[model samples]
Structures are given as C-alpha cells and as structure tokens.
Target: MSNETNAILNQVIVLLNRSLAAYLADAVPWMGRAGAEVGESLTAMVKDQQQSADRLAEFVLDNGGDVAAGEFPMSFTALHDLSIEFCLKKLLQTQQEAVQYLQQAVAALERAPLAKALVEETLGSARGHLETLNELLAAVH
Candidate 1:
C-alpha cells in the first residue's frame, strides 16, 4: 500500500475505535427509555466495529503499517443525561457519516486490493448498521 492508502486506513481505525464504536458503547448504559433490548443491539454493534477494526489492523500490520490507536471521541467523553431519543438520533447521525466516510475509503483503496475488500466489507456492515440505527431512531418516542 502507498503512504496515502496507509494513512487513510489508519484514520478509519481511529474512527472506528474512538468515534463509532465508542459512542455507542458509552451511551448504552444511559439509554433512557430505549431499554435492555436496544442496549443489547448497541453492544453488538460495538463488537462489530471492534472486529472490523481488528481485521483492518491485522492487514495493515502485516503490510508494515501502524494501527491508529486512540481514545474515545471527544464528544463521547462529555457527560450528559442522555435520553433514548437523543441517543438514537446521535447514533444515526454518526452512523450516516461513517457510512459516507467508508464509501470514500473504499474508493480510495482500489489499488490496495486486500484493503479495498476489507473496507468494502466494513462499508456493507456500516450500511446495515445505519438502517438499524434509523429504525431505532424512528421507534423512539
């Protein structure tokens, strides 16, 4: 992979760890009115993000690239007595952004066949997550 490709992939790792997955995980316990079932689903989404990052990181390492390790997104670190409606809204918004970012990453990774495939898979997952998040948001009262 070229330097540009490596950099983009690393950024994606950071996003998954610090933003997408971290946001959901942090908000799960505070899901006012969303209930245990939504929390469970959010937990699963967090795990999926981690697993996808692992796959990307492994590929990067095998190619002599450093994985981007980072803390949770700044927004996630802030305290808030978040409602289920607000949580779902934020999750859906971020999930939508992640999907767009992944689409760009997939396009950028064309020459890096393995990375492209991995990113494509991630993109697919993100799209699925986006749908679920939308449904969750719609159901919120």
Candidate 2:
C-alpha cells in the first residue's frame, strides 16, 4: 500500500477509536440505570457503533494496514455518575462526537473508493442513530 493509503487508514482508525471510546464512556452508567429506555437504546446504538468500528478495522487490514489496538480512554472521566434524565443529556454530547467521527470517515474515504463504500455503509447507520436520538430528544423536551 502507498503512504497516502496508510495515512488515510490511520486517520480512519483514529476516528473509529474515538467513536468507540465515546460510546463505551457514555454507555456504562447510561445503560446501567433502570426505567431509562432511552439509555438502553443508547447502549444498543453504541454497540452498533462498536461493530461499525470493527468492520472498519477489518477493511484496514484487508487493505494491508495494521488494525489499531486498545480502547479509547474516557474524555468525561471527571463527570459524576448521572441519573437516567441527565444521562440522556450526556448521550446527546456523545452523539455529537459520533457525528463528528462519521464526518471524518466521510472525509477520509473521499480519497479511497473502497474505504468510501465502507464508510458510506457506516454513514447510513450513523444517520439512523442520529434520527433516533433526535426523536428521543424531541419527546423529552
């Protein structure tokens, strides 16, 4: 593979790591709470995001790149454990991070058609999750 290809793969892997970290960080307490279907849904969404990241890693390997290792560290490690209500708000922040990650994937894929197709597939799921979050937010408000 070319240096350019390697760089793009690295960037995509970093973004995938970021997405995984965001979900794991956000979902732990959110999913742990009772009476919070939204939180539960968020957990499921995060799981899907993790699978997407794994698929991307597979693509990276298929293209002759090394799969990135380790989980993303929590950026919100300072926050106290939150209630179901507040966790929804936290999830909104997480969803934003997810959006940014998907956008980065879209940008990275622009230079690699096969990667582009993979990212486009991921993008569809991201968009659906965004819509689900939007509906949840709207209902809560």
Candidate 3:
C-alpha cells in the first residue's frame, strides 16, 4: 500500500472509532425504551465499525505501517437543549458523514481487493444505519 492509501485507511479507522464513541455518548442518553433498542442497534454498529478498523489495521501492518492508537478524538455537545427531531437529524448527519468517509476509503483501496471489499461492506452497513435513522427522524416529526 502506498503512504496515501495507508493514511486514508488510518483516517477511516479513526473516524469509525470516533463516530462510535460519539453516538454512544451523545445519542444514547436521550433514548427511553426506544432508546434502549436504538442503543442495542448502535452497539452492533460499533462492533461492525471495530471489525472494519481491525481489518484496516491489519492492512497497515502488512504494509509495514504503524497502526494509529490511543483516542480517536471525539467530542460533541449533549442534545439536552434540542428537540428529539433535531437530535435525530444530527445523528443522521453523522451517519451520512461516516458513510462518505468509508466510500472515500473504498475508492482509495481500489487496487487492494480485500481491503476494498471490507470498506464497501462497512459502507453498506452505514447506509443501512442512515435508513434506520431516517425512519426514526420521520417518526419524531
């Protein structure tokens, strides 16, 4: 993998980790029973993101690149002052941003079939998340 490819993979890993943490921190608290269900769904999504990160890390290692470690640098204000509709919209936006990043990573990994497939799979999952979020937002409105 080229340095550019490695950097892109690392950025995706960081973004995935950061987004997982952010969703857990910001979105989970406002949910009730529905929130619990959503939390469970988010947990599964986090696991998927982790698996993607692990695959990217493996690719970095195979290419003799150092895997990025430590915190992924997530920060978000709580949705305390916001309406449920607003919060859901913001969460949907975050999911869309993640999908965009994964798509970019997939495009960058065109030469690496396995890595590209892994990223594409994760991108598909993110799109599913966006669909669910859209449904939730519609319900809130």
- Give the best candidate by lDDT: 1
Please tell me which model should have the higher TM-score, number 1 or number 2: 1
Which regions of candidate 3 fall more than 4 Å away from where they truly are? 20-27, 70-75, 80-85
Q: Rate the local accuracy (lDDT) of all candidates.
A: 0.79, 0.64, 0.71
**In candidate 2, where is summed lDDT lowest over 10 consecutive residues?**
26-35
Candidate 2, residue 104: Cα displacement in angstroms equals: 4.0
Report the error of model 2 at residue 126, Å. 1.2
Model 2 C-alpha lDDT per residue in residues 1-141, reported as the tens digit of each score = 555655655655566555533544454544343446665566677677678778877877777778666555566554435554555665566667766766776786676787777777777877787777777766666
The alpha-carbon deviation from the true structure for residue 43 of candidate 1, after best TM-score superposition, in angstroms, is 0.4
lDDT of 2: 0.64
lDDT of 1 by residue, 1-141 (tens): 678888989888887887644665665536666677677778888888889989999988988888879777667645245665666777788888999999999998878888899989998988988888877777765
Root-mean-square deviation (CA) per prediction = 1.7, 3.3, 2.8
Model 2 misplaced regions, further than 4 Å: 10-27, 30-36, 70-73
**TM match of model 1 to true structure:** 0.90
